[model samples]
Target: MKRHARITLLLFFGLWIGSPEGWAQTTESGFVPLLNGSSLEGWEGDPTYWRIENGTLVGEVTPTTLLKTNTFLIWQQQQPADFELKGIFRITKDGNSGINYRSERVPEVPYALKGYQADIDGQNKYTGQNYEERGRTTLAYRGQQTRIQPFTQGNVRELVKNNAWTMLTVEKSLGEAEALQSRIKTEDWNEFHLIVKGNRLQHFINGVLMSDVTDLDTVNGKKAGLLGVQVHVGPPMKVEYRNLRLKTL
Candidate 1:
């Protein structure tokens, strides 16, 4: 009877230790992959401007471009109210590329016509700033020609590098007030992190906290929709994006 009791106790302990919660704690961290790296199987974009080349997502621009057939690589997965997005990008030359969040497709207008863009322009004197799509210009700098306001000068300066991989992160929140922010580091491979919830937003670059802007009036009343990558049409230009990833909050 004593031996049986001991065996029963041991069995119960073993089962408890091997329960799902114990196993899940380590495997269920927040990090989730947005891009599968094999193909654009889950994403939709204009074939004319977006493609996966050598495992890096490439967005190309050409002269004499028209609004018709303009391409944007969109995340097929829809997000809820709160989440974070991070990615790495490299711009080959002077052009424009931006990350669009909470965006919807308007057949007659540009993809960003209703979303917020963590704006990118290698040629612009002020790069890596937040701009409200089809809304008020939130930030602007570098003379009237290039403008950035909400994001700090240090944040933009740190995130962007000349012809090198730079980390980019954008965070948004829907709490008491709406907000949006971003950061970047120059000339080195860095990490970009963003947090979005309610109407508040935060941005980080290579683990450095950059901006914390609030009171954002995002499209669609702060709900989540599609995340997109943009390649502005202009003189021939190319941008490479890889290790694209995201996680929900």
Candidate 2:
């Protein structure tokens, strides 16, 4: 009887160790602040567009400074492989921007990056989509859980587009896109979170899961690269980011 009691206690302890509560405690810690909130110290970008204003990272475009191409403000510290990033962002009514991760720089173009982007816009039309900049284009739209398959001639009928470059198969719908968009506050601060591990990428907006993607196209998918925030080529607008934190996994 004592031996059975001991075995039961051991099983209970083992289950507790691997429980959701245990994982939550560990995963919630170890976050390090990425922004100083006072200056752009560990970052690189076009001086004309990126700056720190009143303790917030700001990117602005005016009538005179209309951009011919998108510009990015890159983090110079490290190119994280598996990590979780959390930050708060606000933009004007017509602003368009995104957070780029596991990306590479375009040497010919100043402050340009190409990789996966957590798309953001003032209209909430694409506030939480996974877009591959200068690559496969849209990997997953808002409220989607998608798998990116390698482009092949055999699956041409199932392809999303005309070419092999765009082959995203929707595995399931996470939620209604309009319902998810309602969680975002326009022209106000909204939280954005990203969990990137291996080929799986998940994006959340305002603490709600917005889009998820599993990239199987190893030939075109990126595993590790730089981190950046973009100021897309558009009308006069402003965007601000704060409380940028990262926890490497």
Candidate 3:
């Protein structure tokens, strides 16, 4: 090949390697696995709802052991800021779960987190949205690029009562919600990725951008806290996670 053609080819491959899909392939280099698969060594949660099965981290809510509130399996290693988390998850059809980051434990509630979550559900309705666990609520829906603004001065109490600590503006559309949902595999294993740096958070599913949020609500936004996975309060279901890894930026 000519020298110019060779240089152009190299540039194309370089760009590809820097893309999100490319990051999926190379992120393992700097990431540390969060789970040991054989035991919950650096984790804490209710033993009744969380365990290890077939070398996978499992959280299940059985019919006889229904939960009154969502429960989480929290990683006790560290609370990472400006980091990347990636893992494989599979949930039963009736299941709902999420990966929480920059989160704090609910003081009065056991095994509860109050921060940002990369939402997941067996139905895929909210598979890639950014939802605050017990704080600002929905910051960005699937296929949305949103900016979260601080609350207005008027009726601050009412806003807080309404679970509206922040305001959100959809800056752009990433894609149609249904189109993005179509990319998710139902009741099967899927790769979930989160890139959180400063006040900007982005979620990806199977290398596809599902939601993006630039949080400007410094008053309510969190820079860092705990890392956890939850099993929501609902019917009997099972959620499994494996290959849990994190790379702090």
In candidate 1, what are the lDDT values of residues 72-154, reduced to their tens digit? 78778774457888766666546566777766676685443355566656543334445545444433221111212233234
C-alpha RMSD by candidate, in order: 12.7, 9.8, 6.9
TM-score of each: 0.63, 0.84, 0.86
- In order, candidate lDDTs are 0.54, 0.85, 0.86
On lDDT, the stronger of 2 and 3 is: 3
Candidate 3 Cα deviation (angstroms), residue 162: 9.0
- What is candidate 2's CA lDDT for residue 144? 92
lDDT of 3 by residue, 43-121 (tens): 9999999999866789999989999999999999999989999888889989999999999999999999999999999
How many steric clashes between backbone atoms does each model show?
31, 0, 0
Query: Which parts of model 1 have CA positions greater than 4 angstroms off?
Result: 1-28, 63-71, 110-113, 124-126, 139-190, 216-221
Task: Encode model 2's per-residue lDDT on 11-126: one tens digit a residue.
Answer: 75542232221211112367887778688899999989999976678999999999999999999999999999998888898999999999999889989999999999999898
Q: Rank the models by lDDT, top first.
A: 3, 2, 1
- Give residue 217's error in model 1 in angstroms: 3.9
For candidate 2, the TM-score is 0.84
Give candidate 2's error at residue 144 in angstroms. Answer: 0.5
What clash pairs does model 3 have?
A: none
